[model samples]
Target chain A: MKNRIITISREFGSGGRTIGKKVAEKLGILCYDSELIEKVASESGFNANYIKDAGEYAPGGFLSSAFSHRSSGPNNADYLWTIQYKIITELAEKGPCVIVGRCADYILREKADCLRVFIHADLSFRAERIVKEYGEREESPEQRLKDKDKRRAAYHRFYTNMKWGHAQNYDVTLNSGTLGIDKCVDIIKELY
Target chain B: MKNRIITISREFGSGGRTIGKKVAEKLGILCYDSELIEKVASESGFNANYIKDAGEYAPGGFLSSAFSHRSSGPNNADYLWTIQYKIITELAEKGPCVIVGRCADYILREKADCLRVFIHADLSFRAERIVKEYGEREESPEQRLKDKDKRRAAYHRFYTNMKWGHAQNYDVTLNSGTLGIDKCVDIIKELY
Candidate 1:
């Protein structure tokens, strides 16, 4: 495990963040999720909420991508991507760590030895988890799941020019609904 | 381990067949690759060679699928798919085994507890292995690789209505080029 970087890209409410944290704890490494957003916010002088939103979700969004092409020159998403990329790389360089989301997999792909993992689950499973995790909202869990996943995917595609969850791009892709969060962590740990 | 079924879908020249055999050997279970093809051919009353081609490759090919829908009645591929579906289902019912290719993953999607695995490698890695495995051919290895992968994908898509090699469809997707064949085997074995 010389290149001890693990980048976890996960679907919303798939328990990917939990799995990442558990694996990092087992490996005695830092798991960067919200910590990453804070870092980017600090580095880019943007509000933490703004960085969290724009960093992962696309501006025009997955459904409204019909109007994404209108902007030009270092847009907010692009700027946040640049800053996040630098911070992710620096974090990888700093030491062995687990990075969840923000395309750390793509950012550190060539720069570091990374065990890039994509975590996903069935829509029903995700929808249930989101309700329990985020609490009930006006929007149904399924609809919220769809919107968030689409935006994240759009962001990944827009920034990296790669299909967000395409198996080919990652070293391993795990179905958390089938495999379960604990098993997913165990698998990542086994590979780690 | 109650499911006792492992379905392996792979890109050409990824050593997926070899990996499946090794895993089966280690698990003391049957690895169905050529044996499955033979069974399909026997049951369908088609030549083994024809079954090998049509069972895994789409008619009109992947690159040239503009004319794929001209036929109305059950065509050769559809017929082969039916036989394959039957044989694969029966194999799973028999016991735990590693079933390779022919859309076994999709066929047994709900019928059995299958550890569906997709194996893929970089184009360059596959190109190098094809020459070693299949021997030199008039067509370049890369071209052959492209043609084969496309047809396999087309066939899987046509029959299953699922995207070939999509991560969402599998429990685990491994990159043989990065993880190496041995590591891939060990990971699958660990999960099993």
Candidate 2:
């Protein structure tokens, strides 16, 4: 096969990151998840923490309209997206890899032979996984899951002008809750 | 753990039936697909071929409206659904099983511990598979695949009052085009 890039967009608590890592391990390729933040931060001269905080979140309506007047200048979200887009395209150009979130699918859509995937799970299943993995110290796991999915969907829509998790936008979609992380990884590896 | 039922709703040429069979074989449980038509026919006293022809297809508008006045006398689609609903419920009540298509997920929603899965693939992939499996004697394979998917979607929507192949309606969704049929079977078996 030629250079094939796999981009994963997933709901929070869907085990997408784990699946991506396992796929990369199996395929002997690189996987980018939170590590993407570090790369973008280093390249854009932004703090990693700031990039993490702004990751996969669209600016609010007021801020977006406020930035509209200075479209040439670009807002914080736009700047972050620009830097991330450049990084994603560059990474795809380098070789075969698995990329998680960060709108990498949309950014590298036309640039690479990409198989875009979306991973999701039922709400209760995701809530249970979230509570188990992250604990319940912050917000209710269910609420947090919903909030994160919403934010990711908003960010994806804003950037790509398309629905975040729609099947039409993806080459494939899987439910990590139904198929365990290992099985999900196996499926992805087979595809790769 | 307990007696669990798996319902697979699939797009045409997505290898859903094959996956269901493999999962059932691995789990040592019964799998229902076209065999459902036989059961429904035997139970309802309808001819098997007639039932198969009417299977999963909603009645035309004229017949539906004609049956509307005498709601007690269901149309061919409604009668088939009624018998299949009873058969599905009875099968679930009996033991663990894998049921493919026929809105099994919706029918057994309240009666059993069901894992609802939707299997799909890209159009070109499905078209290729259809050609390889059923040969190119039919209309164009791509057109056949699209027409079959549209019919299945319509049937599911009519019966379940939900979008067929929608991620929201399923516990998990898999792309057999990307993952391959055997891997899909393995994933479902692992879930089982």
Candidate 3:
């Protein structure tokens, strides 16, 4: 585990970020989740909040993707992705760590000895967790879950040209709903 | 682990079958891979070879799927699926076991407490293993791998209305290429 990096891609409200943090803590390595947005924001001169949202979640859907290649260089999301990609690689080069989301799995696909993971759970499980973690919102937890997952998937496909959360792309895919959060962390550590 | 079944879905030549066997051995449970085809053949009166090939892998590609809605009674593949589904359910009811391929995971998704696992590997890793296991074929190992995986995916979609090997469909997915066969077996057993 000296130089092995673990990149965690997750469904919304699946507790994947929490599991990544716990695993990194157990392994005594840095866990890059929100820290990545700070790096991107500082380097690209974008607002931290904007980078947090736009860095991982695409602004639009299929229509935007079709028009994304109009030779206008890179759009905002695309530009953010380029900066995040650089920052993510630099962090991985600095040391082993657990990177949560921001397409870190795809970014470090070839450069490092990386253990790519995808964590997901049942919709009901995620819905409950989102309400607990984010507090009640005007939109139902399920609706919010769907929107976040959709936008994140679009952002991933737009940048990586790979389907997000596909099992073939990752070394391990864990269902936190069935296995629970602690078990997921232990399993990831075991694999790492 | 009482009354808990484990279903394994895998890419061809990924050592999933081997892992399933070893896990069942360690857990002292029955592992049904070819045993399933024999049971289907005995009950369905179809040739064992035919059931072996057509039970998990469909006969044709997208064209056949498009035309499968004909007024005629269920086709042979569809009929076999019905029988396999029944037998798989019956087996799960009898006792906990490891069921491989044949979309047993989907069949038991709701009826049983299933630890659904998908196993896959890098193409080069699987290709080398297939040659060692099955002997060299007239066609390259890569060609055989692609053809088998495509048919399996089509069969899964046509029968289950679910994408085959999707991360959302399973509790755990193991990369035998990176984790190795023994580690994959250990991980599945740990989750169980």
Candidate 4:
């Protein structure tokens, strides 16, 4: 597993971060989840909060159209994406690692040894998990799950021009809701 | 969990049957795999061998076109499908059960409590498992795996009008190759 890089794209409340962490721990490698925001912030000299917020919401149509006009210079979203892409590739070049979310799968699609995984769960399952893990939040767990998934999908599609959760885009897909984080970790370890 | 049905669609040599069996055993319920063939054969008056062989291959274009001409009587594949559908629905009606393959997912799509799981693995992983489990065979394990998946996909597409292994079509997708059979069994047991 020389150039092995595992990129995980997941639905909100799917326990993707935990699964990635467990897999990385099992493999004795580092896992990048929220830590990716810090890395991008440090490397690009952008505020961590800005990077985090930008990463959350997809760019609007106006922003996309504006960015499309000037392909030479990157816009806010494009600049962030480019920085993240550089970090992801650099991380892959370094060694085997597990990456959670941030469209790492699409970023490393051309990498020979990259294993792209998509994790999702049924809506009800995800809702229950969200409720259990986060307790009562401002919005309903179901609404939050849907809204987050929509944003993630939009962000992924805007950047990658691919369907977010389609199995064809991934090497393997896991249902963390059904398998649980530990089992998902076990499976990803063997896969990578 | 009333009227719970687990439909497992899997890649060749992915240990789907074993997972289904373990899940059924843990649930203190019955699993339908090869047993489905026997029941279909007995009920439809079709020879078990014919049913098995027909299930393995996709119907030809000519047969499909012929069936399109006269929609009154069921064709060979249609008749088999109808019988299997009846058996599956009847089984679901009886109680909780785990069904392996035969497009059970699409069959019970309208059921409120149905869980459709798709199991797959990397080609190398599957090949290794087949070699270990089945020993040497006429066809190469890699080729056999591909052929089987193709047949399964075609069969599923022809009947269900949907892509066979797409994650969107399933409630959850498991990579049994990475997780191994036992862990996969545990996951399904918990899920059900």
Q: Which pairs of residues have clashing backbones in candidate 3?
A: none
DockQ winner among the candidates? 3
Candidate 3 lDDT, tens digit per residue, A22-95?
99999999999888788789889999998787765564443277465556666787788778889988898899
The lDDT, on a scale of 0 to 1, for candidate 3 is 0.89
Ranking by TM-score: 3, 1, 2, 4
Residue lDDT tens for model 4, A45-139: 99999988788565654235425546455568778998999998888888888999888888887763777888887888889988988898999
Better of 1 and 2 by DockQ: 1
Residue-wise lDDT of candidate 2 within B31-142, one digit each (tens)?
Answer: 9988888989888999999887677466654224324455456777787888888999888988999999888999988888888888888889888888888888648988
Better of 2 and 3 by TM-score: 3
Please report the candidate that would top lDDT against the real structure. Answer: 3
lDDT string for model 4 (B84-138, tens) is: 9899888888898899999888988886378788888878888998999889799
Error of 1 at A134 (Å): 1.3
Docking class of 1: high
Off by over 4 Å in 1: A1-3, A59-72, B1-3, B60-71
- Which digits, one per residue and each the tens of the lDDT, describe model 1 over residues B1-192? 445799999999998999999999999999999998988887878899977877666656554544656566676776777778888898889899999887888888888988989999999999999999889999999999998898888888877789988899998999999889999999899888
Docking class of 3: high
- The worst-scoring run of ten residues by lDDT in candidate 4 chain A lies at A60-69
**Model 2 over residues A1-192: C-alpha lDDT tens digits?**
346999998889988888898889888999998888898999888889988878766764422532455545667878898888988888898899999999888888778888787888888988998888888856888888877887887778878888877665776677777666776787667656
> Can you list the residue pairs that collide in candidate 4?
none
Native A-B interface contacts kept, per candidate: 0.79, 0.28, 0.77, 0.34
**RMSD, every candidate, angstroms:** 2.1, 4.4, 1.9, 5.8
Per-residue lDDT of candidate 1, residues A1-192 (tens digit):
345799999999999999999999999999999988988888789999977877766655444644657556566776787888888888988899999998888888788899999999999999889988889999989899888888888888877889988998998999999888998998899888
Clashes in model 1: which pairs? none
Error of model 4, residue B182, in angstroms: 1.5
* Candidate 3 TM-score restricted to chain A: 0.94
